[model samples]
Target: MPLKSTLAVPITDDPSLPVVTFRFWLISFFFTALGATVQQYYFFRSSSGTYSIFFVNLVSFSLGKAMARTLSERKFTLLGQTFSLNPGPFNIKEHALIGIAVSTGAGSAYAIDILSATDLFLGYRINALGSILLIITTQCCGYGMAGLLRRYLVYPAEMVWWSNLVQVVFYNTMHNTQDFQSIRLIRGWSRMKFFWIVTVTVFLYQFIPQWLAPILVYFDWLCWIRPFDMNFWAFFSSISGGGILSLSFDWTSIGGATMYLPLSAQLCSFAGVIVNYWIILPIMWMNNYMGVKAIGKPLTTKLFYEETGLPFNIKPFLNQDYSVNETLYEQGPPANMAPMYALGFMTSFMGLAACCTHVGFFHGREIWRNWKQAVGSDQEDIHTRMMRVYPEVPQLWYAGFYLVMAVLAAVACEFYVDLRYLLPGKPIANMTFKCYGYMAMSQCNLLLSDLKLGHYMKIPPRSMFVGQIWGTVVGCFFNYLTMILIINSQRDALDGTKPDANGLWTGQRVQTFWGSGLIYGALGPARMFALDGKYWFVYYGFLIGFLGPIVLWALSKKFPQYRWWSKLNVAIFAGGLHNFPNGYAMGILVSLITALVFQWFLFRYHKAWWTRYTFILSAALDAGAAFTGLIIFLFLGGGLSPKLAVNVPSWWGNYYTPEGDNGPYLAVDRCGAANNAWTSGAEL
Candidate 1:
């Protein structure tokens, strides 16, 4: 099914179609804002806020709408022919497609971290101006790079199939007056009916675990103790455990933990899992356990630890505090948690290495190609090709604008926090002009590089610029504040064990801030980027991220028999499985299955059900999950707190003994100096 033929709404011969109404923009912006916020909150639990979504979504959608409106009024020309027309009030296809694409790229795992980190370090606080810049910078940088590479990735047809295009085309055609009569079964009511039925069914199934299971069911089943046996029963029983089990089962069987994989490369990842779980984990466990006597230290050894109690093995430390045999319990569970860390670290390291190698190779080629082309080389490469096709305003102009804006941003951030020395000799002003000027300029340079990449890729320059600027501005402001709130709230969970000026203390800050940031950043990228890169080969991984759909074009040349493969690729990539494990593999599998099933249905039953609804249905399901997860964390996960403290009882024996209390205990003040000893003679 060629998208252009199947979903293209024939442009009307008449030029009297009305442009999109303000009402349409308003309604669409609300929904897009709601959806984006829900997705962000869930994906980046700590950083995103309910309100942040409103502003970010409003800006992106409104800007997008405005851009579309502007474009609708313009006349486009190509190859000496005028392509003049009015795109009515909502080219439902184009706007929605842009929204979905931006959501996928920006809504994934590390987006929150990226936004939050930039805000904290760069000092962009959450506000209207900052929000605008954040969104534009991040989105533009990523999309810009992606767009520039799209010719090499998506246009090749052999490189990427971009399946989501089908859905956009289908919806547009259905809504367009000129095309509504072409498909008898896909009238307005029928389309609504189909969507409603699928949406309800998916909602019920997905919601069961998301809402009910957390409260009613125990997640202990997921604990390491049950392991294989637990997963086996869970897999066969319900969808709840089935999803997780699928991941675990696939991890073990596929050995998905292997080192770097190359583009269009095929290799077994299952072997790596086996080595890590069967060999590496055990060895690390044994080493830690046997060496415990030498390394064994109480949780209260350090002030940070004593104040927080061991963050990971809290229960064990708690057990030691209450139990008669304190030493045994302290050493037991602590050993177990170490293995999970080891596994996580190994996977993260491998993934990072793969990313570095992949990005390095592609960037090197790009640099060399640009140099050669500039000096008049023998032939033009992809970069030269992109520059010729999508020439932009000069780099210097953008650079200058970026610097001016970045400085303003920094100044605003400093003033907002009352950190006036950021401007020198002033300690209590909202923001000095100098700080704003510096930060804005710095951020702009970064944003420009990202945009340049987008321009080269031929991604609509407007979309790239809008997305990046919005993401960067929004992220720079809210990320740090959110981090502080989350950290302070989780303080009790973090502190080892100590009394502060106000009594006891919890050290959740470490975990909430640094620990979680590092862990999430590592794992999030690993699961998505690491797995996807293998299909493209490490050397060509950057191309996969940017130009994934282009594979369809390349493949079509050799395997004309599998023309549908191109369509399949597009759908999977467009729908948001670009970086998932077995994403490429499952893409091939699903495409094959769908093709066979569709062929049978179309030929024997004469129905276009699969062709019409699969992509939409998948997107809806994913959106549901994203929203549900967001709600869960916001309402159910935990609330923010200002103070930090742990109230747990001491393990082993109390290091301190009151003046009146007795019985072979040592007395030490909060400062760790020995005040007294209960025993007359203590063996020193």
Candidate 2:
């Protein structure tokens, strides 16, 4: 690895240590369930917090140690194998496996997004069996690719997959605590103790912004200045307008990735956000370009009717059979999205194109060389040398598992496709096709990263394979179950009947997915992006994204003195900008500040403190926010007690009558007039 100093991880191994034991299975399953529950539950929320592996690591450590101490190490035989209730002492390998399992299980399946989009927006539902098969297959289809590429991506020491190094360092930290000394930031407190303290503190504090006094989530001071002025509200209100200085204090709003991501990446994303939302959106709305002013806001993800400036009703555009009604579609105005939403799509287009070229220009040669060398070279790093003791997982095993999953996916997809025209479900076919095709590559990259983590930890390849499969299987079920529950209970919020008061249950993510289906499936790109169509200009994002990096690459080569040009990543910038339009306007400002503080200032100035506690701090914040948010949903938001729940005393902070609706004129800041300020050109 180029960053050899960071890779000074221990290379020693004790093969006698048990890789999989009774405790391993127990802790792995426990964490898989816990992680999945938390992740899937939060997946639909506006400020969807993650149940990160750092949180998993800490909890598993305590659980593993406790099991070792409490459980009798009595040996037992099962299916021709010997096992013990407790493993020899919760070694690093077992700890590493638990992390792997949780990481595999915690991600809400990508297929769930497709499923939820169809269920909520398109008003279609898959049978439970079909849903299960779809999720499992989509998740596992990437394993074969990962196995095939493992020689190039995993075994090679140079293919560092830099992000994995953080987790590897953390594994060593928690397991080998005595090697490091406690710092004065917390004064003699160890990393584990510090993590628990922060987690507990954040858990208690999250209630203020999450439940009680929710106005603080997006503390828009400027909106308070001219609360009733429609023009000012349009310009400054965080909820309905350009989110300038509007900052969210909640950790969930400011994602934990800020702690680790490079400052340059954050800055690039911020630049995109500034250009698209702050500048372009306002200009477009003012000029009424593409009838954007008719959409009622300069920046929102909601789809709108071009004529009425109201929510677009897909029912009108569809025939009785759910297929596009050519007569109605030709007669009605095309579906309109907010200007920012259009730009957001442009960002996605740019991101995809930029990603390919960026990789080619930057790392393509190195990767090609690595692939060639991986097949022939005998060279090895210390970690790779130590890892050789464990018998590698057979390629046939991965290929077999992948073939089975792919077959299952094809069958399920065929079943769905067969229902086209018989049901309003053509989108399901498109979504499934996209999911299996795209997710396999995405999942392969993820699996490769995890494999690298295993490589670093000297985990037995077979144990890694077994843990990944088990965890993925567990994740599929929990992800589906959680999606079903959320769609059932939060149907009103999800389907736009009754939006959540505190902005927690917006379903904007699935709404975005559904919007994509409308464009790609219902509307079709030919109609939406035609030369004379409204979004034709958006196709140019591809050109911009593709050529932008090549220009930067030339500039870097020409002016080597400007070292920063080489580091600038246009793809990251595009991806970051693409993410900002997902309902949290204040998140842009809050997350940028967080990145500067955690990744830039802290790392540059206080290296010691940053090294010891930064990742733990990030973990604690995510865990605390996740646990607190779940509790709010379960107990206060009617998960447990439907009738008695949500009985909070109404006040300015909790007054959540949506703007422009009947009940309340104001929504925490009396910005209702903003909704009426604009008129569709046809209406005008």
Candidate 3:
């Protein structure tokens, strides 16, 4: 029996209901809003947004419910004919499973884009309106582009298995069955029980680390651990005494680093990380600090002059300071570093080369063959096959419509900001309007390229387009609005005690204005500067993200059954690249762990049960973590004032002071003297 069967509680479906009925909209709004809120909170608190994990759970649970109802409607259409797969009411379990599948695609893309935009533009601040706008624009663009490219990417038999979808299906089917229930024994529970347990565990873990840590979670303590120190000696001694050899378990240094990856890709990525962490960021930080210093101004002097009249202080560092120099060395404690530019250049070249070689070698011949087949050869092209699977929509029409919408969105943004004129004495140049149009175009191009890749793999184009569209629009519009609102609310937090030489808020608003301006001028470099001057780290991160997928692609080539590796690649890469402070590591670990457990159940016993139960378990865990995070932030953390505050002894209390009315907050005093100040001017 399918795992879903075991967990199958019954429900109903009503197709007669309007697509945008109040209930549907309400549910969508509530879940999306909750996700938006939590993501924004994390943005301000930790400077990283954990949207993927949060949304995965929300969409899974909600969609599961919706699927039950849809199944009850008992209507099926195939090849323009209505037929009953089952004689009576639709199987609630099957419908739920399908819902899980679709929801995974929808929610993952949604969360990814949301977090990406906030991380890139707003520093995770809570701007409800801005966030919404960002989300809507990005999602809309993504959808349109995906639709255009879907005919090529999704529909071929070769693309039957996307990694994330397969994982969802496999987990749900395998765990619910009786025969392979022992697989769940690894976690030591039935599907439902395991779900609850993991959910609680992860929730507690994420919250405690963020809220109750001895020091601010953002500080890089691990980087600052000196080898010759007494603390280090004690730590080593304790580990030795406890029979736990640090070297034995240190995965990074161990062969485990290369164990699962292709040698070339691994080496490139590892080298990239080294360069990012050790070199580029340090240079950027020194440059920025020295730039101000050279001008005979404190760093804070630049803050007040910023657009929002806030102080510069650490807020800019926390918000969007991802330059080559800022992202890497500037983030944590001072360390002996190395040159990064060379390493980054080398790795980037390697990655580009690898992508070219891999695609050319594996796909080039196929492309030619398909072209020949399309011209009336015996072999049919993938595109032709896909077209048979899903008839093409009028893509040109959609593209034109997208263009029109892009113009309107730009106009709306300009109108909102009242930037219709170029300068004090110039005619309305529409420069801002043109720039937005360019942004829309760029988004569309990215969507098209990704969709094309999907089409070649024979995945369903419609599904791929759907995911991208939702992601793009949600990311661009709603995401933007949310960020704006959040930033406004926490204006004080962002503006540290420094009066810019000109006496401005120099905090969040300055970063936002300058960062946006920089981004507009040069996307890659500007983003680097905005992120943290840690340009090398992001460069390295992108390489790492690309490598994981390449490895998975290679594995799939070697072992076709491991086609699921491709999906894993996307999940792991997305999880890691989109956040910082070892977010990628966390994503990789969690996904691999989940994959292992899921694989065991599917291979050893009932496949059906494994599919359903795995999804349920993942959803439950995600939901728990999200809600718990929300509660901790809103209540224990004094509603985001002191996210990392803790209540401890006076000695510890003296070591840290609460940012707001909350208890002692995380203090990394040694990191910088300016951190002690309440305003941006203190740094100046």
Candidate 4:
């Protein structure tokens, strides 16, 4: 079935209402400020988790409604049209735009953490303004790319992003009432009523695991069964590498992601996890093949160097200016990459491979057709035709936008030449090329996702471009501040090996981020993984990624009933194993279960109900969990003086007392103190 949509009707049927009001901007800024505070708080926690602005909707919507009533309806002429200062009433479009602003204001930029870790842990000095500008440019680079390709990317109807469908459904539901006409939805109920019921129930029940009994986050019964034997307890560990099928009772972290993904997509990722981590890596380690005996940890590059008794020595490779000395590095003794590290590095190649092949296989024809129509000015998409009333933005406009961001990016690199290796846009020898590979992997997905967002919400391309580019600028400032605070306050915890007094700050994710900057930025992939290098076999991952999609595409076309196989997500195969020094596998498991129960069963059994209730239920669950988590963090203290700690009884299940800060019993990867040969650098 051809996907169809119309924009003849306004999103709220009230465009004349005020949107750029004092109330809208104020609420958005407040939310952004709150998000910054939350980021700072979460950064110091022992657990590796992030908080999203799920609950902001409730506050913003309420305030927006109140402002709509209180503010006056004074008329003003902007150009030819009359506009109201009060806007007859606040609409969902206003709410969504504000939400987008808030999200952008507190958004994460990759460069912020990259610079933070490099400066704090790696002993590099990055200028404050340089760091900020770098973030702005890289973040905007993706948007400019998105704009250049908007004709193909955004104009198409099938570019529906599963993740963003929740927002689209919510907007129409709140403003438009056609869907609610006399239809008994899932469970022979009304969607409006059901959403409220679920929302309230979720909001209440979220207090249990988050506030009272935190141990339910990791309900590892295996540890309780054999408290005396360290080995038995270690087998079920969730944090370290040995999470071998551990259960997480926390619904927010676990099942929250599945609300968007269908069952087959979830299963594909789960299968990849099981096959790669559960079956392959363990087997290799058990045999001690490929120097697995020397592997220090899972999901790390630095540990590989440490394990080989030849940790990276940055002194020999750094110029007098503290920049990487390209000549010396190319000739220097190559760092020996542990097999485990090489295995993880292999995924990047697959990610790159999949980006090209996946697009070619699925949306190639439609994209081509869209391009022709857009250029020829015939049979433009319905969305594009509707948008013709507004002056069409020229491609040159996007080109100029790209130049402005590019110049800023280059200037930042020049200003902080010492940290130039971290700048992918810079024209450095191997560093820029290597960084571009990672950028392509990310930007392709970003452009596609942004297109879907615009298509779903009917946002104009020019407006979308402007928002994304500048929204990035707004986000980078807060993100930079958050990074600086986290780094300076918790220096030792920046690498997660050292446990703080409160056991709150863990640098697990930073370790991963810093490690990548160290390798790809400082050492360069040519020295680490190219021919004659230690990790040559890692290059084959690209072939695997490229071939996987081709094979899957062929199979699906030949035998469409077995189409589930075609849905084998290449992104999962490419990037899934690379994620978790944080150990999100428990979350992945819970996500799969939710997809099976909610998306597969319910969606198949009751179609209209599934359409109506799925997104609302998801939104409700996310909002509930996020709200509770925020409250607990702000009100309830941590470590010894935990707020509201007295509510729960002090038992094994309630309070997890550890001989070591981590592990139910032992570290999952069987790693211990590196006192023996931790700093043994290269045989230079």
Q: Identify the leading candidate in terms of lDDT.
A: 2
Each prediction's TM-score against the native?
0.44, 0.92, 0.53, 0.78
Rank by lDDT, descending?
Answer: 2, 4, 3, 1
- Candidates ranked by TM-score: 2, 4, 3, 1
> By the TM-score metric, which is better: model 3 or model 4?
4
* Candidate 2 segments whose C-alpha is farther than 4 A from its true place: 1-6, 180-185, 316-322, 368-372, 376-388, 416-425, 640-644, 657-666, 674-684
Supply candidate 4's per-residue lDDT for 466. 49
Clashes of each: 110, 0, 138, 5
For model 3, the run of ten residues with the poorest summed lDDT:
238-247
**Tens digit per residue, CA lDDT, model 4, 104-182:** 5554555655665666565764778877777667666655566666666566553335556656665565556655445
Q: RMSD to the native, candidate 1?
A: 15.6
Q: How far in Å is the alpha carbon of 277 misplaced in model 1?
A: 5.6
Supply the global lDDT for candidate 3. 0.37
| RMSD, every candidate, angstroms | 15.6, 3.1, 12.0, 6.0
Model 4's alpha-carbon lDDT is 0.57
- Give me the candidate number with maximum TM-score: 2
Q: Which regions of candidate 1 deviate over 4 angstroms? A: 1-28, 44-89, 92-192, 204-207, 215-283, 286-346, 355-397, 408-513, 516-613, 629-684
Model 4 / residue 279 / CA error / Å:
0.8
Give Cα distance to truth, residue 264, candidate 2, Å. Answer: 1.2
Query: Residue-wise lDDT of candidate 3 within 165-259, one digit each (tens)?
Result: 43333333442444534555444576546666766776766554344442322222332243222222212211101001121111111211122
Question: What lDDT would each prediction earn against the true structure?
Answer: 0.33, 0.76, 0.37, 0.57
Model 2 per-residue lDDT tens digits across residues 1-684: 256523456767788988777888888887787778778887887676778788888888888888889999778898998877875788888999888888888888988988897788768787888888889999998999999998777877666777777777777876787653444347678667778888899999999888887677767777666665544555566666776677777788886878877788778878877665566655765677766666655665667887777887776676654567767777867677776788887888899899888888877787777666666678865677788788988899998998898788777766753335312224455666678788899889888989988888888999999988989999889888878877877888788776665556778778777777776767777766788977777888899889989999899889989888846888887876775466556667778878888888889999887887787788989988988987887777766457546755766766754341323333443444523542222232
Residue 23's lDDT within candidate 3 is 29
